[model samples]
Target: MKKRLAIALMIGAGLLIKAQVGINMSAPQAILHVDGQKNTAPAVPASYYDDVVVTSLGNMGVGTKSPKTRLDMRSDDRQNAIGIGGTAQTASAAKAGALRYNSGTQDLSYSNGTVWTALAHKAPNDFVDAENPSKQSFTSGTQTIVTNWTKKTDVNGSFNAATGIFVASKTGVYIVSFTFSLASGTIANDSRYETLIQTNSASSATNKVFKCVGSYPGTNGLSNRVAGNCSGIFNLTQGDNITVNLNQALGTSKTLDADATLTSLSIFGL
Candidate 1:
């Protein structure tokens, strides 16, 4: 009876041990092999019972609820890594990769690698008057010279005006010139004339005057037409005006033409 009890106890203990024993796998897949003996089971397809994370390492087996690691046995390798958070990280990456920013979409797109795109809020090169009869107004001292219609005036170009002075709408360097011709049947000795380019206002503070004299051939023909040119450089502030002044005090009032031609009206950085 004692021997039988002892045997029963041993059997119970063995059974408990068997139930608690666990099988260890060399890899994620179970491939059993016996040492110094022929294989009993044929090779079966290997399937991982767990998810495998591969890195630069050797293979490791995990339990049912655990993970596995597979090795990437590369001879040559170089890498460094870090994790960044938030939208700023994504934005920085996109920009560094040369992505396009879409304001409407609020997203970035990879560049197609060709053709330049227009930047935001860029100014155009030239100013254009889209509408007709672009009325440009400029003020002259005492008298105002208003032009009906004319092309872009060049430096030293002549302008015909009803008034004695040619009002300058555009301020720049100019070589002022004048042409005076007497009406038909007028004699040379009849009258004298003066053509001048002067500042519009009369203040001793900042006024400059330039003048020249010539005889106008009577209107019998284009001959005796008095023409003269004066050249000078002027630094004119924007909105400051200039005009041509003709004095016929010396001669009979004859039809006179005068112009303020811009020699070079260039702008530079102040």
Candidate 2:
């Protein structure tokens, strides 16, 4: 009796191996089809129904029947995350088109055959600002105008307008420009109308400065108005501060105009 039962079980296993297999399905659509919810009436299972299939081409599909690629996944949850969790990978440990999570850096990254790189990316700093909404004032001497800029396009938060300081977030060659405008005030022609771009803190021993002086040789004053424009290219290191200065040798004080066209500051990495 035991031998007869063994022969019957062998026949059943042989039938299952040769024919298309279906679990909770009347008709199979692939080599192996499993319908956890037993959804058979609909040609395609709804998102609520959990289904899996191994196509004739040996392609696997989850929550779908007609898979377009080797492994197709679809669901209402909207998350088709696939993780390759394991040990940290060496630079060339994996072949091209491989992905892994770097346990050392805790980063999800991919390999380009040569090295593993983090998938997350960030762009360098590039900023433009204009208009001193709060009109400012300055006396006759070099003054920091980088502060108090009202409309700042500080996407990367690389500058602080309140403190009039710009700290570089990356080491690169940057082009910094600024324009200082006077509110129709008296600027006597004393060859002192200048704009300066300074790098590093004032107390730093290795301070760098770029200065531009406007040449107003006429005896008459500049319609009692003066404008200073200057730009400089500097190799800046991270944590370095940038200061835009305006020097005017005037007896009386002058208030800054809230004009964007007349005054502005712009900086970007090269």
Candidate 3:
């Protein structure tokens, strides 16, 4: 009785294998729907399945052709297995592992889920100014013109090897003073004379402001030609010019050369 039951089970298995569904490789359908719903169209949910193991029978792969087939199965379907016989691939799956745009003209691109672009451009600024001169000059006259003072000097009214004058240019008040010296070219302790002078544009007294004479009249009623010095400050203007000249005003036989010079000159603006 057991042998008879086993033979009947074998027959039932053979019938099940014979009646199972399969692909007819000789003829292919462009669109295949098992129950009234198409299977090849990508599902709205982005993923779905159909009832039986369905596949492409021609050169087009599954999902490549219109209404292509899909198999809905909880487990692997080995009974009615369809061969992946076509070389055609779907558009979505074709570009899945490939780059979209890879041109040099494209500034932006994607890499490893990140978006990137090229860098920016920039530059700096420039400027320049005028250079200053190294020296200035003043004449040997009674006019006390202010020097173009690029710098200050320790030697006031003293002969400058570069400019020959104590120069000034900045407009302000100053204590204008000077010292004079007499040389003994004629006699021993013959005479000595000193004078202080300050002048500006407002002073019309022969281009002279304040003049002070310090000397002793000799036996001949004239200044002695020996050694002398003098300095003083006067109420001055911004561009005031001042000067001093030596004279034998108190003695006779008096010979005075360019031995007299301004020892110190300054202006203190108010």
Best-matching candidate per lDDT: 2
lDDT of each: 0.34, 0.72, 0.35
Q: What tens-digit string does per-residue lDDT give for candidate 1 at 27-146?
A: 322222111122112243122222222222334232112124352212112121222222323434445434454432223344234432333442211111111131322221123222
Candidate 1 residue 54 C-alpha distance from true site, Å? 39
Candidate 1 Cα outliers beyond 4 Å, as residue runs: 1-149, 152-185, 188-191, 201-206, 215-226, 256-270
> Per-residue lDDT of 30-60 in model 2, one digit per residue for the tens?
7888887786555444642367888878888
lDDT for 72 (candidate 1):
24
Minimal lDDT window, size 10, model 2: 40-49
Residue 250's lDDT within candidate 1 is 30
Once superposed on the true structure, which residue ranges of model 2 sit more than 4 Å away at CA? Answer: 1-122, 189-191, 201-205, 215-218, 221-223
The sequence of per-residue lDDT tens digits that candidate 3 reaches over residues 7-106 is 9999999886545332432222333323223432333322223322344442222222232334333322223344322223343443433233322222
Ranking by TM-score: 2, 1, 3
What TM-score fits each model? 0.29, 0.54, 0.29
Screening candidate 2 with a backbone cut-off below 3 angstroms (N, C-alpha, C), the clashing residue pairs are 185-224
lDDT (0-100) at residue 200 of candidate 1? 52
Off by over 4 Å in 3: 1-168, 185-194, 202-208, 218-225, 250-270
